[model samples]
Target: MTKVTAQLSVSLDGFYAGPRHDGDGDWMASAESHGFFRVTRWVTEAMSWRERQGFAGGRQDVNSEIVAESFDAAGAYVMGRRMADGGEVPWGDEPPFRAPVFVVTHRPRERLVRQGGTSFTYVTDGVESAVAQARAAAGGKDVAVAGGGSLVRQVLRAGLLDELELHVVPVVLGTGMRLFDADLGLDEFEGIELTPTRVVPDPQVTHLRYTVHDRTPLTLDDRGAGTEKA
Candidate 1:
């Protein structure tokens, strides 16, 4: 089965986006205005995905490669209603997804077909159902949870996510939307059961990959013993 994965760019202090991001164009403007864009510069500055939206310059370096790999891994996407609505501004008529996107929302709307291969299907049935629909639409490829924070938290809390890739930026947005700001008591889970599988260091950000297993991961001593030469 294709892994249900999520990728997000978060600040060192755990903020994803700054406050006041209610589908307004300001969210994508200068960082001085929308602190969210400041943290997300890693993705927006390097990825060719920005070019698809009529942006001028983008990188082809390590960061861009990482971004490209993430894009290639997804056959379908699941995002919250805010992400879908917020994206319409910067994304124009042909959003960069270029694949089927299932949006989780309380308000249902007709399927929206955009230019390029992107299509938006609203789901009022919640995260699991949205994920199910995204996976089916994805065929055999991975269903990527492209987030706006709240939806990502919901999926994590539900234990539906198989992998979580966090691009940890160095900056700290003191007050903003946080990935673990929900009332789920995530403090009780981090570094205990959520095991880090890989860590790729970059100049601008660090890519931290974790696998969500049913039980806690091995301790340092256990891992050392498992790697001993026979």
Candidate 2:
């Protein structure tokens, strides 16, 4: 059984993307504040690899530590169409995964073969099907959910997430997409807050780690204490 984890970079105001995300998303979002650029460069650099096949964005100390911690743990990645640009991936065509990647999309398309050892497999049957495919491809490591809002919402709603690693960029765009855009709510797990790291330029970017817990409510005894029954 593989753990399903969501790693996202959000602003201090709790938004992943800022303003209008036209093709100029990165450039415009970066100009919003020094923290934004710091986080962006950090995230981009975190995914960069020596093979030049994965996302080769600029590097950052914070992102390097965080990404290096998680990227290698997964056997496959599940992403939304918006994040499918050639760069965000680690390997599409050799070394990183050499495994299948399931992408959720409304439009249908053939598999994409990239320079790296990665391939994009488009899926439209919905989140359940995508997760199934990802689990099957993942073998036993983990399934990483690359976000675009809707996919994360779906996975969260389905109660399929095992952990979440969020990076707070420390800037407020006043508008844009969000990480938790779900329509429902449930106390599915008790999350333990991990260490928080600050980023460069403005020193506002923060990264938080949490582990997922799924357990049934405990039964109390008549004396208002936990029951000791087998």
Candidate 3:
């Protein structure tokens, strides 16, 4: 069965991106200056990541293997419009993701066909629709929710995410874009649970994988109290 999975590199303080700026100039500069690169430095230094980006020479350690494994597991991807737009220039003609990518956005645009197997399909409806399309396109492989925080939160809140992989770096950013800044709006009766599946420790980063389990809401009694039925 195809599973919905998400991966992100976060700071020790739980920030994926740096602080938001007011104007485009400030934002662009801040994006570069902030802890964004620091948090993702591990992957950027990996041989697998370097190879995908058509670069030369990187470390072929455990981190590289993990990166390769993630890329191999994902057959299709779903991401937010902001992330897609931001990556367009950096990713160039041959994007790292060599699979069909569904972009969740309000504005409708024609499908973008790139070099290799990468193609961007803009989804105007919602995240759920995007994930559904990605799953269908995955061809029995896992659907990767490549995100910019908000998209990941939306998928998790909607109970569409099946697995989550967090690359926790040691450095702490005092102020930045937190991965869980907003409420997930989980069930009041029975909140969601994450079962730890794997953990890979490294000097620069710690890789943690969890299987998301949405628990059944508890039964309510006559007095509106929560109860578990026998």
Candidate 4:
């Protein structure tokens, strides 16, 4: 079966990117300067990442192997409009994805064909629609949710995410956009369960993979609230 997977690199404090400021100029450049670069340094230094970006040399360690594995597993991708816009110029003519990318947005736009096998198809409806389109395009491989926190949260809340991988870096950003924020609305429910499937410890970062479980509701009685299995 084709699984829906998501991967992200975060700081020790659970922040994926630094806090956004008004008039911060270019969002991408500002994020890099704030702490995005520090959080994702491991990925940037990976040989697989460098090769995908058309760069020559990089470290070919365990981290590089992990990066390569992720690239190989994903056949299609779903991302938010903001992420796509921010990455458009940086990704250049031939983006590393090399597969069909579904962008969830409110605006409607024609399909964008790029160099290599990469192409962008804008989905105007919602995240579910984007994921459905990606699943159809995956060709038996897994669909990756390439995100910017909010999109990932939406997928998680909608119970569409199957697997999640977090790359925990050593550095700590005092203030930034947290992956698991109050906006997630998970606090109201019993919360989703995650079964740790894999753990890879490295010098630069630690990779943790988890299998997401369906949320189980809390059993309420005359006395108090208790837990119950799904």
Candidate 5:
């Protein structure tokens, strides 16, 4: 059976992005982060996959190896409107994802074809519909959800994710869009079950893989107890 997977980079402080600044230099909501580039620098700075996507230069080291695994055999992708937005940076003519990508948005649009075998199909219904479309497109391969926090939350909360690969960076973003936000909270004390599958350690960051299962009550310390042994 093909599993539904998601890959994300989180900070030591559990943030998916760095803090943001308002026009008047006042603090905005936690969701108002600068961007994920700074937080995900460990992977972006030394990833071979990035270079393969037409990026200039990056170290082809352990970090690169970890990053490469995500793009190896995924059949399709799903992302949120925010993730697809050009507010931060546009993905350029050709994105790293060379397969079909379903973008979840309220605003409907026609299919967008890009260079290098990548095509974006706008999905207006919801996450489940997008995942269903992605699964149909995958054809026995895994459905990889490239998230920006909120979408991943919906997928996980709806029990649609099968695996989660988290690359925990060493840096701390004091205030930002957190990967584990309270809005997606479960019943008090209810916990999401995660069985450690793999751990890839690097000097800059640590890649952890987990097989996600039904929700139960478990502490974060209990779930992640022995996962860092890489």
Candidate 6:
């Protein structure tokens, strides 16, 4: 079985992309050490999807372990069009992702092939279809929801996501895309559980994991241990 999980970095203010994201780079641009490019490169190299997608070298810096662990069991990846460079830059020399990369978009484009083992597969259909295809490609491994926020929101809104892994960067951009900014009624999710995690710097930046219980509502005794119901 394949699981769908949304994983991304967020700021203290709960924003993923800043107001100037359109003009500037990404939301993490204003933070120290950024970890923007670093994270992207790390994610690509981390996935089992990388075997067929694309990858670039010159990385292997800090945070490699966590990056590697993310996809140690991942089978494939999916993301919104914005996450696909917004169809801008042609994913040139060192492209980031390396799985059976599925891009959700209404626009039509030819299949994209890149360096270091990667190819782009565009899906015009909705999230469910993408999840199905991703699972097929994942080969029993987990499916990761790559995001620029919109895509993750769409899946979450539809109650399609089963998990969420967040890596928080301690910064107060005050304005940017947020992981859960748009109201996604909590009721839609059953057995919603959250686990708090901290790294060397504690709150400076932390990694959290959320798991959704089966769709049906459950009683208190039905809740699993180590899960802080949301």
Q: Model 5 segments beyond 4 Å from truth?
A: 20-35, 87-89, 217-230
Error of 4 at 91 (Å): 0.7
Q: What TM-score quantifies how close candidate 5 is to the native fold?
A: 0.85
Q: Which portions of model 3 miss their true places by more than 4 Å? A: 26-28, 31-33, 187-190, 215-230
Report the lDDT tens digits of candidate 3 across residue range 115-156.
Answer: 989999999999989999999999999999998889999999
**Each prediction's Cα lDDT score?**
0.82, 0.65, 0.91, 0.91, 0.81, 0.65
The worst-scoring run of ten residues by lDDT in candidate 4 lies at: 221-230
Q: Which tens-of-lDDT digit does each residue in 1-230 have in candidate 6?
A: 78888788777666665552455555455542243433343345533334323544433433445666665656788888876865337466445455677788898788787765456778887778887888889878788888867788778767788888777666666654567754555554454444443433433346666775434554457457778778
> 65-168, model 4: which lDDT tens digit per residue?
99999999999999999889878999999999999999999999999999988999999999999999999999999999999889999999899999999999
Off by over 4 Å in 2: 22-39, 45-62, 85-99, 185-204, 213-230
| Model 3 TM-score (2 dp) | 0.90
How far off is residue 15 in model 6, in Å? 1.0
* TM per prediction: 0.85, 0.68, 0.90, 0.91, 0.85, 0.69
Candidate 2 residue-pair clash tally: 7
- CA lDDT of 138 in candidate 4? 98
**Candidate 2 per-residue C-alpha lDDT over 1-230 given as tens digits, one digit per residue, 9 for 90 to 100:** 69888888787677666543455455534533343344455555553433234445555555565666666777778888766753344333453545567888898999876554467899988888888888888879889887766678778767777777777776666666667654535444532223333333435456666665553445545983566676
Ranking 3 against 5 by TM-score, winner = 3
Task: Please provide, for model 5 over 60-96, each residue's C-alpha lDDT reduced to its tens digit, 9 standing for 90 to 100.
Answer: 8888877777777688999888677642245778887
CA lDDT, candidate 1, residue 76:
97
Q: Is candidate 1 or candidate 4 better by lDDT?
A: 4
Judged by lDDT against the true structure, how good is candidate 6? 0.65
The 10 consecutive residues of candidate 5 with the worst lDDT sum are 26-35
Sequence-dependent TM-score of model 6? 0.69
